[model samples]
Target chain A: MVSSFLSGLLGVWVIGVSTIDAFEFEDEVERLRYSGLIAEFRCPKCLNTNLSGSDAPVARDLRRTVYRLVDEGMTDDQVRRYLQARYGDFVLYDPPVRANTWILWFGPPFLLLAGILVLRRIGSRMTRVSLSDDERARLEVIRKQ
Target chain B: MKRAVFFAPFIGFIALVAILYAGFHLNDPSHLPSALVGQRFPGFELPELTSGKVLGHQTLLGEIRLVNVWATWCPTCLHEHTTLMDIRRATGLSIVGINYRDDGEKARRWLSLYGDPYDFTIVDANGDLGVELGVYGAPETFIVDADGIIRFRHVGDVNDGNWNREFLPILDSLTDG
Candidate 1:
């Protein structure tokens, strides 16, 4: 009797958690796409939060739009473009590489290359340090002592 | 070469400071640029705020106007209400309001109390139109040209300072040409 009651309670708990973001999807692939798209987009109101994570009204509306588009069999790229058209590239976490965004994409790798070059230059200087003849003689005398 | 190498770190530090300072002064981080600018305003069929009459995007076409997003819940909208009224009175410019994510009854009451400046307010209780317009919050205004294309968008209150500085130039150009 206790086991049966416990199982019933677990069922209720599972239902409760599942219904939190209770958008129903007939197809598993569509459901996954909906979830993926929401997680990918930034909430316009809540700057730091993704659509999946934000409870903002705008986020909720955007989520519904994404769900509707996915259900209608729109491709992921089309869905992204739809949002990008409305919200600009700011809605996407991964901004496309464009003239303005070139620095954002290439700046880090360029910095790494520059850092390596700088380190190599410093390393060469340290390794190629040569003692003068007087200093060498002094060092030899110190070694003999 | 050696002097250049020695001064590199200082030059880099100065460059970093200059970049940061420019970034700080150049743009307001909270203000997201609108993608709808220069594009036709998104099509929508929504009800009018007072009357139950359903309206479409065609209603707003053929005029240079200000489409202002507002809500009873947003305190800033209340602050901006008088400015909108002043604009309406001064220029007789067509101003349309989008009642975003708000109860119609309360919105109606608020407008009556505050004096409605909108020529015809679009009821967006569910914020569907707000989503289409990329509205993040209330008190955002869009300047739409006579051709129904959005010319510019201003986020936050349409105060006198910004009116003169940011919006006036655009408004003047749109009116003149």
Candidate 2:
């Protein structure tokens, strides 16, 4: 019984130490917001990893900045804007709709519509091709045979 | 309409080829556009690398200078150092260094080993100024005009090839204006 109690105490101490490294939030909502924000921004120093996924020094700095901003009662949009102002729109995973980025936003749908139109045209043409009377007669002869 | 539709794919193929070819000729796509261009240099009161004396953004004012971000750990900075020295020798352009996230002793040693090209190096030990300036990595050079406004930023090494082709025109234009 004494050994089990000591083991339980050791486990609790280990958990406490691990938790100390994690950011403490007043509420669960704040914690969720912090995680969401870090996952949303790309690590500037890294090739393609998000802030939460990267071990780059710059990513760590950015994560701390995000935590501080969230803790200061700034809204999610305000936090995004703060990072965007410093790092440009490159930080945001979702590129903002702008004149240059219109192609990125609208290109796929436009291509899909064009594809549908082309496919529709081909489909309609396939149906519109009537069998010639000579071909019909050949078909009738083959069926009779 | 049918004729045009028939040629649509061909036109798209040509367009795609042209775009891809142009993209191949363009600079590295990973180079992020700087947000600080056309804006005033961010204010800071960081210590000088050698002196440890606090200096502000005002020190960079009243000149067309290059603010180069470097670190002892970054190998590219070492590769770009000779070019920086050449530019300093050739044109006498003021180059200010921001020693980003580096140990002061190593930085001083590196500078002494390789001839110093900067007007005065700023020790950004904690990288607060680096964050404010939107620096993600080392060897980023910003061209700051006389009014202390950032004109252009080059993300990679500044060599003779790019120095003449990319940087000199901007410097010339800034001088003329």
For all candidates in order, state the fraction of native interface contacts they contain: 0.59, 0.41
Q: Count the backbone clashes (under 3 Å) in each candidate.
A: 0, 0
What lDDT tens digits, residue by residue, belong to model 1 across residues A20-100?
466879865676677778889999988888887788888888988998899888999999999999899999999999997
Cα distance off (Å), candidate 2, residue A111: 1.7
lDDT of 2: 0.87
> Model 1, range B96-118, lDDT digits (tens) per residue?
99999999999999999999999
lDDT of each: 0.87, 0.87
Most TM-score-accurate candidate: 1
After best superposition, candidate 2 residue A52: deviation in angstroms? 0.6
Model 1 RMSD in Å is 4.4
Pairs that collide in candidate 2 are: none
In model 2, the runs with Cα more than 4 Å from the true position are: A1-26, A130-135, A142-145, B1-25
Off by over 4 Å in 1: A1-19, A131-135, A142-145, B6-10, B21-25
Put down candidate 2 lDDT per residue, B17-118, tens digits, no spaces: 687688777867679888878988999999999998999999999999999999999999999999999999999999999999999999999999999999
